[model samples]
Target chain A: MSEIELDLISHLSEYKRIFSFLTAEDIMKKELITLTPENYLSEARVIMRDKRISGIPIVDKEGKLVGLVSTERIIRALEEGIISNKIKEYMTPREKIVYFSPKDTFEKIVETFERYRYGRYPVIDEHNKLLGLITKHDILRAILKQFHSIYIHDRRREEYLNREVSILASDKFIEDKASFRYDINTQSISEAGEGTALLKKVLEKRGYHRDFIRRVSIGTYEAEVNVVIHAGGKGLILAFFEEDGVVVFVRDWGPGIEDIDLAMKEGFSTAPDHIRELGFGAGMGLPNMRRAADRLVILSQSGKGTRVEMVFNLKEGRD
Target chain B: MKLKEVMNTLEAKIYTGEELLEREISFGCASDMISDILALAKPGSLLLTGIIAPQIIRIAKILDLSGIVIVRGKEPMEETIAKAKEERVPLLGTKFLLFDACGKLYEKGLRGT
Candidate 1:
């Protein structure tokens, strides 16, 4: 689904492939109960009740997902006596909805569900076509299906697989490693660095030294700002806590940097004059990231996207 | 210097974090470019900038700055005020130009980081 997947897969161990190879498309329910934007909340309420489903995806005539109306919205509309209103007025808009691509790995979907705490997420294609819906039950069923093929006769192995998959699905692994991941909304330039700010707060609460948090947050902020300024307004920020350091990744599906070497040079910027007016695009984003982190590697393809991985060692003092 | 003293030095107005006026700040940095601020700013320093975007509030929270002094008496956007209130980052406004405000703070024995 993505070229970057192979690069990461090649680096992971053999056992990790089991989880990485399986994706949302493989597990998501193809048959879905969906509604159109023109549908009324009264109609949606009756459909949801008859189908016994808590939520439904709202799509256009072209089958592109436009919104989602959950049971909570249904109750709110009923309370407000607006049950007869159109579904668009009562649905969570597409811009705010957390969705998954068909090609996304199971681990990514699990992590997203854990982060957003949503009951279910719509699976869509690159064209925004509503492909399917994924839920926690779907994830568990996928794990079961995997185990059924391999450990059908081995009860012990089945137990181990169950334990492992649950660990992967829940926040247990993240809590143990202190990994923090967030989706960066690049649509608004003013909301940049929010993930980094939250990271700073978490590190502070965990008793990290002020300078250590500052270095990590500074590096993360620069990378995130790049996503907002250059990237087409969608990015992901993931930080994995190591024993003596931290690893952060900022990935954006933007036009990849044509020449990373030139981009790394101080004061080299491709940003236009309008962006410069907002106090960004000074050509210092990469250099600042380099200065703040102990090690920085930027992986990018011309037409695909750019992924910046920064490593910070706690034992090392500031440069 | 206490943040209150810096507020007095610039004859500034507080937009948020009024309860944090008693906090001590040692250094001051001024910049219109956020990258420079993130690259060069030190922890516990005061940030003086001509910008009032919401990202400034986030940067202040990340850098653990003592406060932000919006130079040139510019009105911060409503979203910026909301973010500052949420992040609890002290935000103040000043009528003096960026250069004069920095000079006044320097004259008062507040050094740069």
Candidate 2:
């Protein structure tokens, strides 16, 4: 097995109880209102409105949960012009339910929620009697805790991309003949890498050929990766493909780089020590971008942000 | 060679895409780096990777890879497998390490074009 696979396996095994850790009885709201199958549609609506709730469980005369009535069903009924006063006409008879015992863990709850994508789950006792409701908000809080753990675990990964890359100056190059005008936001460079890939796909979808797409992908990938790794999470990238070429604009909100000459030096990287351990920040990001792009420009203001624009010309009638 | 031949050569298990065993793959690249695979691998090539990320299937979609071989007994996440199925990309798993798996295919005359 590769080291990465082993690492992933270990990680999965370590977090086996992620769902269990997030579920608990306290997260459920026990003050649930019940309705009968014979209740009027308007009556259910009034109860929902008064209770400030979107749904209510339907119970039989024995107080056993039998169905569910929600706002969506009411809207559908209105759309279908169903003026029937019976709750049975609108309630979901075969509703999905989630039941949790006192011994059930938070990880299981999270797993169930993610698998089902349900807004709410009803917790029940050993006898399968509904005791309370656990809404999506409770699961979201648990997921947020997982995010926090991941963020802390990857702090070094975050710090590597928190520096500034120099922005080269450029005269405004705008084209009026383009089909679409895309305003590049260079302020959020962390997203540039993924954005560039998306832009290339967008161009190809519009009938750009393989070679032009490849060139744009290469240029955008390097520029965006640089923005993410060096711009301190404060760079923006905007791109649009035109009839003649692809235009890319990148901006950053870091301390303006002092020496473009030194910064662009082939192997010069100001990446912090921890970034090197992760196998990135070798300073080739900018040079690679320069090599791939046809025209490159940079603009910067100290303590504000840097903007870098690049254009890749395509062969006319080559689509 | 056919996909069944490749599977037999490597002693791979078919996780899904069983009906696609007759599909032909002329070449393969074994890499865990998704970016490298996206930038380097050719269309219709078989991908051998130990990395189990959703992006693996996403890259396959973008590049139009024929199949994915998750080596080292690694299984893709459920969502990733579902995507492969949706895209009609054959997925296989094997207990061999990446290098050994690639070497076995290379020895069987599956050249990287």
Candidate 3:
């Protein structure tokens, strides 16, 4: 079971204690660097440099967060023009602003931080006046406290699971249940087939990035085509994602590659002449997938199937 | 030079963020490669690039670039222009090639530090 579920089951009472200790207002930094919209971009840079901050709240005369200014905006202005004489010229105006209040919970703040990838958020009062700022560092500190609590709760959960397991064994003949089943197959082929489109759609639905999905889809399609035209049979392709990364296994049961190392070279395809005429095969499928995936492993036996397993890291913070 | 003056000098069209043209920038970098511009350009610098793609505007958004100048008379697609507009990033286009545009700006005393 996941740590979160374990905590929920074994430490329901301690959860309330954890909640009571973490309030949004407790983590906010009351001091913030503020700038007026009338200031020049150079002036904002100075403030940012002195404050050692990447972003600053742009305020009006009333001290409300009218917008935000960052280093990126400064660089953009210099490229667009030599100089921007005022902050309003380059300041990102306040629209779709996400702010937090002191009354909000730490969990909600964490959710917001994760969703937006914001390093810091401006804290506002009831009048929408800027009160302070809550940064990722502050959130991290709060989460650390929760982590400690979770650790203790997890220890208790292990004890509970142990006790439950003992009780289950005492009750004998408990049925074993299978939650899900997946069938994997591998084959080699040298021509493109109907499965290419189906595999592409499946990977797309599984939430791969568009660029990566395209490259993998093309690579897999080429591999399939290679199996049909050169290897003379369909290749096998299987993939599953674990917490650590995605694992894909492809194999071709056709006549095995004689020179695996030579075949791995770029532009080294054994595709038949007719397959080459279609402008689909360029002898770069294996190399392309190798470049795209975090790990690539291949095993082949003479006159037997060739197996290829590829693993791609679940890129952090992408979700 | 102020952004207003640069816009006037280039006779460029502002597709969006008209209200922000009065801002000031300190330096400038001219490049077509997004990665290079992101790495080399300092904060508060203007970016001049000849590449016209939605990815350009998306890069501007990620880097929080104040504005983008599309050179070589290349106009951004309508969707790209709209994305820039929505992000409140000013978009400008000029007929001059990359080198000449940078040179003219340099001649106009917009030297990078």
Candidate 4:
């Protein structure tokens, strides 16, 4: 059983406690069925069949999730008559797959399933470390368990789950001062918005002004995108929500900026051709990120890493 | 103003979510970029754009925009229409360009939030 389930089963007597704070970390598959890049496709196919799963998470020697081999990849491999190929030869690169982390809200999971309509997603940590696996079934099952037992079998339980849970963040779960961290992978457009999107909900639930949230969202997004587009290695975003506003720090273990002054100038870009082809790396990210934040400070060590700290102060009243 | 009046003013075709035409809207924002829409536009504002892709609908849904108007008589692809229907965002097509759509909506008392 997952930790959350254990917590729930133990807390059955006091089930009136907030069950909606439940997140992906509570039930993700800890004993993950994963594959290494060097693994053979035929062996992977057999393991997936035996496990009754349609996809296999691919990890690196460091146990970090580097790619995935889905049933679609399997079919494509068979179509090319290369069942003997290595997992890396057929797996979807890490940058392309849509994934969520353990801290992600159940609402975000539902939105992802509805938006992308994918069957399953690998659950990883901020460092690209594979933690567990999650599917639509897993989410629905966990959420359903949160009801009835907690609310004394009332119609309001149905209304709360059906209406408020889906439409907005649970107002009952708001905390004034909270913090969280997220790991960002390289080159994954799908995962680029994860941190910013999740942060928006935190700010929204606290009744932060829309324009304040927008500035935070915009600043966080550009920082996230910069990590994916240029950070040769992985990155991390640390978010702190205080009583007045929020502070975000984006740090990456990639080749740091050789010239901070030049990089900050609008329309000055060093992004390669393929990244440009993707319609990003237009040299505007740093400037935009700066423009959206109330206070922006950048610290970098060339050939080492870059750290950007941004502050968003709330207005006296709603904007 | 209700979306139907905006549709009439722009002479647009309803591509999806016809039932939502009765929904009221306050502001209009014109942009072809999803990032711009996501970062700038307010929820319940009208999105006037030339880019008619599934992504536009996704942005509108994420930002909780009131509806969309695909400009220059262009139609959103079938896939885009299907996603818009699922997302419950009304889609309108207008022969008028993006600037004209924004201008007319502005004259009618709409402003970007």
Candidate No. with top TM-score: 1
Candidate 4 TM-score to native: 0.49
* Top-lDDT structure, candidate number: 1
The DockQ of each candidate is 0.53, 0.03, 0.01, 0.05
Cand. 2 TM to true fold: 0.46
TM-score of each: 0.59, 0.46, 0.31, 0.49
Go through the candidates in order and give each one's C-alpha lDDT.
0.81, 0.64, 0.61, 0.72
- TM-score order of candidates, top first: 1, 4, 2, 3
Lowest summed lDDT window (length 10), candidate 3 chain A: A166-175
How many angstroms is residue A149 displaced in model 1 relative to the true structure, after the best TM-score fit?
41
Candidate 1 lDDT tens digits, A1-319: 1345333333333234345557899879989988998999999999989999889999999999999999889999999999999998779999999999989986677567545667789999999999999876677677665542221111234555555332122222343353798888757788777788778878788887788888898999998888988897789888887787777878899987887778877889998787788888878998888888866767665666777777777874642
Off by over 4 Å in 3: A1-21, A144-319, B1-113
Candidate 2 deviant stretches above 4 angstroms: A1-170, A173-194, A225-235, A254-291, A296-306, A316-319, B1-5, B14-26, B62-64, B82-90
For model 4, state the Cα shift of residue A71 in Å: 76
Clashes of 2: 28
What does candidate 3's lDDT look like per residue over B4-100, in tens digits?
Answer: 7778777777777789889886787777643345344554677788766655665554344557788889878787787777767788988888888
**Rank by DockQ, descending?**
1, 4, 2, 3
Q: How far out, in Å, is residue A261 in model 1? A: 1.5
lDDT of 3: 0.61
Q: Tens digits of per-residue lDDT for model 3 on A197-313?
A: 455566667776654544444444444545655555555555554565455555577676666666667667776665444333456655655655555555544576555555556
